[model samples]
Target: MPSPFTLAITGQSLIHHDIRACVDPGFLQIVEILKKADVAFTNFEGTILGRHGGSPMKGSYFGYSDPQVLDALKQAGFNALALANNHAFDLGPPGILSTLEEVRARGFLHAGIGLDRDHAIAPGVAAIRSRLIGLVAMDAGPGPRTMYADNARYRRPSRPGVNQLEVTRIFEADRAAFDMLATIQTTFQISKLERANYAQPDDPPVLDEDAEIDFYGTIFRRADVNRRVIAVDPDSASIHLEAIARARSREQFVIAYLHHHHWEPNWRDVPDWVRAFAHACIDAGANVFVSHGTPVLQPIEIYKRAPIFFGLGNFIFHTEKGETEWSSPDVWKSVVATCAFDPAGPLQIDLLPVALGGEERIEGLDFHERQVPMVASGKIAQQIIDDLAERSAIFGTTIERHGPTGRIQVSEGQR
Candidate 1:
């Protein structure tokens, strides 16, 4: 039988500062958990500013980290990183290239943004003790198209960007609302202007009498009731699945990851579309599926013996001190999941609750001391596990609590 392998997974790491010098007991405890695992994975949430110097693509919200932060993550025992996210292109193409260079130089197994379309979509593979682990990562965005990588064509050059899984937001309207929108469109002669200037030759065909109308770039579909629907482009999804399948065929334990900004009205609620896509990834031979975008933890699902984490929230969030958007306590509380896979036995997942600074006043701490995750205990730990259990129950995933930790055991028969 193959030897047992343990994988430690954490959420987004938007770290900008170094913490290798910190001797906090709580912080060190969190690091110890990661060190015990054969492989530890987290999403690197920002671009590394390196030799290929680049300019910021956004205003103050732009995310660019110094190279020393990579050293900090390595010190924290993270061996695998997912680099596909909204902020991956904060410093533009140069940032992508620089990050790729820095991560590769450190001997880290990283995937997501790459030199071109094919490279971005390819899996990052590395051999652990007794298993080969592969990571296929992507971003489903509400971001600019320029942020995504594309292949070199006859005339255009390849773009160095994130591996993008195209997603379309369709607004569903009732018959009356649909007709009113069409009337407004015709009255303003918007179609004429779009056809003459805005619409591309490859744009989806628009028919006045059809059930769907392309109002500018947004799609409005006629349906029985008014609602919003998130649609994943079939071709884009197929491409990602193909990469996962290819990696699995190579006998690698595949971990499929997605980073997206499309959240439900309630940040903690998992979107149906995302759940469906996670299942599709498991169907395509992904041994584990994880996602991180929303700053709060969502739900978990166990499908076909594979664990699916809809959103793992923030592991190491180092946002600006003045940023009040992440003030919610839920955003600061999350769990570190460790999955143990034994070839001759069952799969066991242990969850250790953690708090980012643990109810401390954000204004009191220095930049270096703030936003670092520590192991949670007592009431804080119970609260985190209870919330996670309640949400995960929606997907029929049961979590048994043991003191401050949670556990989920899947028998071999489930596989």
Candidate 2:
């Protein structure tokens, strides 16, 4: 049983959600559960910086909780956090800088994003029970040019900066022909893009090919790794390689948390490019691939000897419309809507929340911890376990339950 290393993991995003609430009981619950664990980890969902005067993204919101949040985590007995999720850069460079500062100040280890290209690509290391554990964080692909961390305490990058990867795929069979047609179409899309002295190709699918090929071709060519027009999306092969490299380092074990957005359940809705992106992560030596951004809980599957827990859902979304996805039956509806659940199986993870009023609390927080457990009591926990078990059955994975309290270990050799 691998020495029965007691592990109690929670999936809570660190965005500003009811931050001022009391959380002593919640922290104590975690301390009680993970007392014997060699290490404990949580998902730092939001960027940790004070909301200074920084421009938020055009189509999104930026956030920053007080630096004390990191202290709250330390008090709760967490050793590390996966910082590679979607909202990591909600507030740009300043937020990123503050997040790093807070993490360092708290003597906690974080990974998945960094100050510059080099730092962002690097992995994080922490010592737990004398065992060195390596942590790596990555985004799905490239993002806007105007994104970054911007805190007054830290210096910002002067050049055009982007932290996400932008990758596309092409099938070997469609390469040469697709390229020929795409070149012509590319000329038509932007007449100025064509070289004045260059002769445009007179191909059958000139317009169609040019439109498809030009966009995909240019992007793929940027990295110079694409051959045929197989897929189109921002999935960076370089980041995948980096993750692989980081995981290969000598450590007790390597766990990577990547920020990607592929949470569709419909077989047809599941894009081929999305699967390819996930495959790239798996190929990169990632042991556990935790995905976010779909904002819903997906199935837990083992891919290429690694356990991939897609869409851990939102852990601490203060901005949610009302109740959390877990508190609402809609999550279960989505679970059943996309996949089936096994009644006689264990739960996927120990779903825990960061309750309020502990060592990590702000002076103004009014959060109450007693109400949280009362809301998710034994009966509710049992229901969640049953629901998750049934869903696991659909993926040929068995999730059995030996009791309640939202603690169900996924037995091996059951698929």
Candidate 3:
């Protein structure tokens, strides 16, 4: 609504220390490109390690960032961040509190982690120029239960944590798989002694060919037919829908993002629940949908005139000195997405390749060994384009390469 605007986005960035000097000259151009966008977003993983100075907290060190290092992010032009990641609570409540304080003081729009459910789930809006843009963020699981935000009753104070999308797992199988699973579950059984046996009910058993069998609180049918099922908690979906509608009323552009480790067998493909969630977001009035968590790029889906990036991989896949166990070679490569939307023209999307690695840093600022996301070239760049083109093909999304970057082709009707 405010003329033609562009949004540049990226994947997860994990920095435990300041990295102002980590980026080389070529990569600084990409930072400038991000600075020039109307709105720029990224998945800001970890808690802002502020006030505590360089002192470590009582929880896991998986996600702890020095507060001063945020200046480096500000220098690179990241105005918006999503914070409902697995490591949001790695440093516990104190870390969460510090992160909120720093992010607000820096004047960046953020969503997800907060002191209560409403605070965590609420959309963070930014009035950039004359346009009001809103963003809502959540983390879906098959993940650590302790990371979820407290939704305690009015009388009881809510705990500090990240926003959550509840996940209910539904397991299904045919006759053979069902029987095999039952047999396996039986192996862990503890036989009851004769003296420990309790009185039985007088009611007769209800048995049918397609009858339901209850084992260890899991229900399965005896039928031979094949069935596929997924359980997305209705309450969580409804809350997200409500948030989207509320944001739609006050803003010209609404962006929704989710962070999850849920994935399918191919690694590049997303879970069915994620697809359903994306569709639901569009139905609820979101202009763009994005997902991350798995440190590799997944497919892009087009739904109801909106774009959904299932996963954007890792924009800065740095491995800290104490984080040797978290190392993965594939995560070092990623894409910087440039999205253009016009009220009178077709939408356009482009991706620039990046490689995360650097040795330079400011003196006396070393909280941990850090690596910067640099501009990628040669095979590193080519692989990212090829992977995106191949995976995005499933949704009829096309990508073209012109050296180290690629362009996403979308027609007027599709947008």
Highest TM-score: give the candidate number: 1
Query: Model 3, range 1-415, lDDT digits (tens) per residue?
Result: 4587989989887666666775477569779889999888988887876773333433554557778767878888889988888777777767778888999999888898988788898899889867888889998855555556777887966777888887644445678977875676567662223112321211122323254434443345655665544567799889987899889977558889998766665566678888888889988999999998987777777776678988888776556455444444455567888899886667778888876662223122332444567777677788878888888888878888988789876667773
**Tens-digit lDDT string for candidate 1 (334-403):** 8999999887888899999988875453323443346588888878899889889988988998899999
In candidate 2, position 332 carries an lDDT of 22
Q: How much is the lDDT of residue 58 in candidate 2?
A: 32
Question: lDDT per prediction?
Answer: 0.89, 0.49, 0.74
CA RMSD per model (angstroms): 2.5, 9.7, 6.7
The weakest ten consecutive residues by lDDT in model 2 span: 332-341
Candidate 2 runs further than 4 Å off: 1-7, 17-31, 34-36, 50-53, 148-163, 168-235, 265-284, 320-328, 331-375, 405-415
Clashes of each: 0, 48, 0
In order of appearance, the predictions have TM-scores of: 0.94, 0.65, 0.83
Model 2 root mean square deviation, Cα atoms = 9.7
The per-residue C-alpha lDDT of model 2 at residue 16 equals 54
Per-residue lDDT tens digits for candidate 2, residues 1-415, read 1122333444545545333344545434545554445666667777765543234643534555666676655655666777765666666666776677778777666776676765766678776655566776666533433453222334743421224554433333246655655565566664434522232321111223333433322422222343434343334566545666666645335666656554345321233455565566667665455655554455566555445555555444454343332343322211111111122442244443232222223222233221221113344445655665566556554555556433334544343
